[model samples]
Target: MQKLRGALIGCGFFAVNQMHAWNDVEGAVIVAICDRDPERLAAVGDQFGIARRYADAAQMFADGGFDFVDIATTVQSHRALVELAAAHKVPAICQKPFARTLSDAKAMVAACRTASIPLMVHENFRWQPPIQAVRKALDAGAIGEPFWGRFSFRSGFDVFSGQPYLAEGERFIIEDLGIHTLDIARYILGDVKSLTARTLRVNPKIKGEDVATILLDHEAGATSIVDVSYATKLGTEPFPETLVELDGTEGTIRLSQGYRLEINNAAGTTVTDVSPKLLSWASRPWHNIQESVFAIQQHWSERLRDGGETSTSGADNLKTFALVEAAYESAASGSPVEIGALL
Candidate 1:
């Protein structure tokens, strides 16, 4: 099979992982790179040995030879960049928080659909090994018919150090971190019908809420809680780990902090390790997220090659993005927000 040639925009802190994952992915390779900052662009280009580099995205699209464009820039640039790729009839993989607003995300998806080009959101949380294990257990009926679930990620980790801009945003944890947990809830439980949320700005230094607890009512008649906090200081920091507790009609599934998965049903209790592999370029605590980045990117490449829809296509991500909007709205209003109305 011919490998997919990809052009990546944004040479920021996280984009480096995408570049590394692209190298590891079986059927994809980044042929070009773009970033507004010449220094950062050249640094990433040199680090990855990508000679085709650009400071302007428009110019890159104009002279494009790649099969897909990966928009790894921040949320503010997402819609415009995705639309630009759509205009060029190029398949695009956009980094999440899909857009600045749900409306913008819808427009981006519509633009790609109109152009008949594939559009995927880099929602890699569901692709994580532990999370995938939880989903698999549910699928195998080990937890026959999940009715209640809790997806939690509480950490005192200094995420703002690497991405200092995270502290500057008016909408912090819910938009940045809670979004992933929300997507995981949808992935493991099902689509959400309604959401009620409460937010708190525990950290005085940050502009937005550092903590959030959201209640979700799934369309499949399941209830779930997605609670995320960057202000939490635990005995042992589960920095990048998303712990899960799922209760089904027949049993329970627990994905603990140490990558331990436990399932208890009539058949008896079983414990298994679902740790993510540490890639040569990956380090501790972050290896889980790094592995998922490769998993999602590899999925994108395979789907792009096979002419199939991605797990988190732009259209599907609108549902997840809607939950983010509803969380903020519900948090502010102190009421439940209908997910259907937002979508």
Candidate 2:
């Protein structure tokens, strides 16, 4: 198989993990890198042994020599970069919180569709091992007919230390973090029909809400709650772990803290450790996320080569991104937002 050459457009904090993952990927490799910061571009290029580097994305795309472009920049730049990729006829994988707004996301999707380029939003939370385990159980009917579910991500960890920009955002947890939980909810239960949300800013220092609870009515007639917080202080601190509780007609599935997945039904009860593997370049608490970054990238490579639709294609992620928009709209108005109406 011919190797897929990928050019990455962000050389910042999280993009380091992406660089490492791309190295470990079987059929894809990063041949060029672009970032506005010359220092970051040099640093990541040296670390990854990538020789080609560009400070301007426009110049890099004009001189394109890669099969795809990975847009790992923040939300504000996502739409422009994706459109740029579409214009250049390069397949793209963009980092999430898909865009700054639903309208922008829709436009990006439309641009990609018109260009006939494969576009995937890097919503990697659902690719995490434990989360996949929960989905597998539901599909296998370990919990016969899931009727209600909860996806919780609570942590007191100081995420602001590594990414100081997080503290400066006008929209914080729900957009940056809850987006993942909401995507996980859709991935597990199904599509949402309506959603209601309430949000609060527990910490006075931050500009955005630190806590949020979302109630989702799935089109499949299932109800689920997606709650996320950066303010919750637990005994041991389950930072970055997404705990799940699912109730079904004949059984239940629990994805508890410490990556323990338990399923109980008429057949019996089984508990398993569904922890993510720590890759050589990955560290402790972040290993699960790092693993997922690799998994999603590999999936993109396979699908791109095989001409199949990505699991989180731009069209599919529009639904997940809509939930974020709906959450904010519902929270401000104190009413249930109809998903179809927004879509």
TM-score of each: 0.99, 0.99
Model 2 lDDT per residue over 1-343, tens place: 7899999998999999999999999999899999999999999999999999999999999998999999999888999999999999999999998999999999999999999999999999999999999998899878889899999999999999888889998899999999999999999999999999999999899999999999999999999999999999989989889999999999999999999999999889999999999999999899999999999999999999999999999999999999999999999999999999888
Tell me which residue pairs clash in candidate 1.
Answer: none
Please list the Cα RMSD from the true structure of every candidate, rounded to 1 decimal place: 0.6, 0.6
What candidate 1 gets wrong by more than 4 Å, as runs, is none
Instruction: Please give the range of 10 consecutive residues that has the lowest summed lDDT in model 1.
Output: 136-145
lDDT of 1 by residue, 146-253 (tens): 989999999999999999999999999989989899999999988999999999998999899999999999999999999999989989999999999999999999
Model 1 lDDT vs. the true structure? 0.94
Error of 2 at 96 (Å): 0.6
